[model samples]
Target: MTVLLTIIVVALVGITFWQMSKILKLSQLKNVDTSQVANDKDNDTQGKLMLGFVIFIYVLTIYCFSAYNSFFLPESASKHGVEYDQLMLISLVIIMITQIITQGLLHYFTFKYRGKSTNKALFFADNDKLEFVWTIIPVIVLSALIIYGLFTWSDIMNIDEEDGDPLIIELYAYQFDWRARYGGEDNVLGKANVRFIEGVNTLGVDVSDSYGKDDKIVNELHLPVNRKVIFKMRSQDVLHSAYMPFFRAQMNVVPGMITEFSYTPTKTTEEMRNSEFMVEKVATINDIRREKSKALIAAGDEGLETYEFDYYLLCNKICGASHYNMQMKIVVEPEEDYNAWLKEQQTFGEQMSAQASN
Candidate 1:
């Protein structure tokens, strides 16, 4: 397929060159009488060539834009991208139609008005009907698009409780780290603050509320597949942004207040983890020299393509100098495994708390 496309592109380019050569040849001819020039038919080939080139240009441009705009861009948190894309397409379509119509008309006029032996300029008065048609047509088309854009923008930006679940997750960003708090079994998040932070109190979660007992402060976020996730973002020290490229979501994480954004995670973190882990294992074993290879081979005789893990929480914001290093490994396991991990973290946190109090 690629080879075929390459050949076709080459052929078109060659044809373009051939047409340009003919246009130059025709242009070099000495100025003939206007009547004679208008009567000539060979010069028409140049106009056709110009039209073909314009079509080719539009095709290539549309192809590249569609490929990049649709497939290449990752998802973002802002409901902004979706509507923006639609608006862009609408605008392009309008422009293309205008260009084609105007260019065609201009070309036809150039041929019709070509100078002639007759010393007479046809005086055709402009019709108000034509003027009204042109003006009103654009106004109507633009108004329709503007209304549609506003509707899409409103739908995505306004969180619909009727559509999405109240599954809230508080995301806190530090200078060089990220922490997540799941609403635990109750699915109700507890209050949190930066003032309460101690050497070990990473999230500074205000556990004073009775509801805090069921609130789980998991360092990483574990999302179920095909579920809408609403992120409640906060920054402890500096300004930060919560950016999830895959979900096409982004929102600012400020210190004083909270910001929110939502998206559906169609792909599970487990899938992402396994994919990345497999690649890492391949790279890790590639550098093993013969001396160490013997030991590694003996330890795992089963051809070393063996590590797998789920995807993780990544902070795309620059909160501080070490912002680039802020990330937490996430595992999107089955509900059973996810629950088990939560239980383990809870027990461990409790143990640590007991030891510190003692």
Candidate 2:
């Protein structure tokens, strides 16, 4: 019913606009094209009105979008989200204001000297004062914006772990799959290398290292609230990107050498419901979506929706045909729940290991 009503309303609006346009064409106020006739005082008013209307509409559109973004979206993520909003707002304001001033001046100049009676061209080719003023003003504004953006970017990327709780996780990516390996109860990641990769040991865990035994491969990651998580990202097959739009974080995952990036998750799954950007942000919904969106054939029974959750992972890079299948899930929990979840995952890995031996 809602869809039908919406379609009917849209059709009505479209017909009304079409009729109004046809009526306007019938009573057209034509502008004189010839230079002399175009410069006539009688036609100048129309040109000025057109310019004014254009400027007003352009500025109105930009500001309205900025207002909707800042106030409409709930405060979900911390500095990352808010800074992006503020940056977008400032950028829109700057662009719209500059465009209006430049365009308005151009239109104003067009009419200001459009008199046909003046036979000769103006003697002055360029005004030195005008040149200096415009050049210096733009340079100053551009410099300020660049410096401000750099500082904001630096602050967002800084994830120092001198005092507060910081968890280090290894994120591995391949042709079309993502995986996360938590450091486990010991809180130290076991060594991993591409050269050590075999069919069964996909992650290339260094079994020689005693610590490697306890280091578990959790399909879904559970992060503690408000804790800084530094992910050591590596690509096994091709280049991939680690993207978390909600946190305003993305890093390139290159093969051979490992790339690193970090973000502190502030909003929980319950809190994410209120965020406007959250709808577009995939990190929170990644695991859930992956489980729900899995093909019935690949995942066994077609009726099954939910699958196992593992450490948070995703393939942001379009590597190959199966790139669509690349995904991993994350579950952000309270400190106690995160710890309990970690322990349970470790237990499950041990059980699976024992079963394989039998």
Q: Report lDDT per candidate.
A: 0.66, 0.71
| Window of ten residues with lowest summed lDDT in model 2 | 303-312
Question: What's each prediction's TM-score?
Answer: 0.58, 0.69
How would you encode candidate 1's per-residue C-alpha lDDT over 176-212 as one tens digit per residue?
Answer: 7778887777677767788867655567766576555
Model 1 lDDT, residue 202, Cα = 68
Please give the range of 10 consecutive residues that has the lowest summed lDDT in model 1.
70-79
Q: Considering every candidate listed, which one attains the maximal lDDT?
A: 2
Instruction: Please report the TM-score between candidate 1 and the true structure.
Output: 0.58
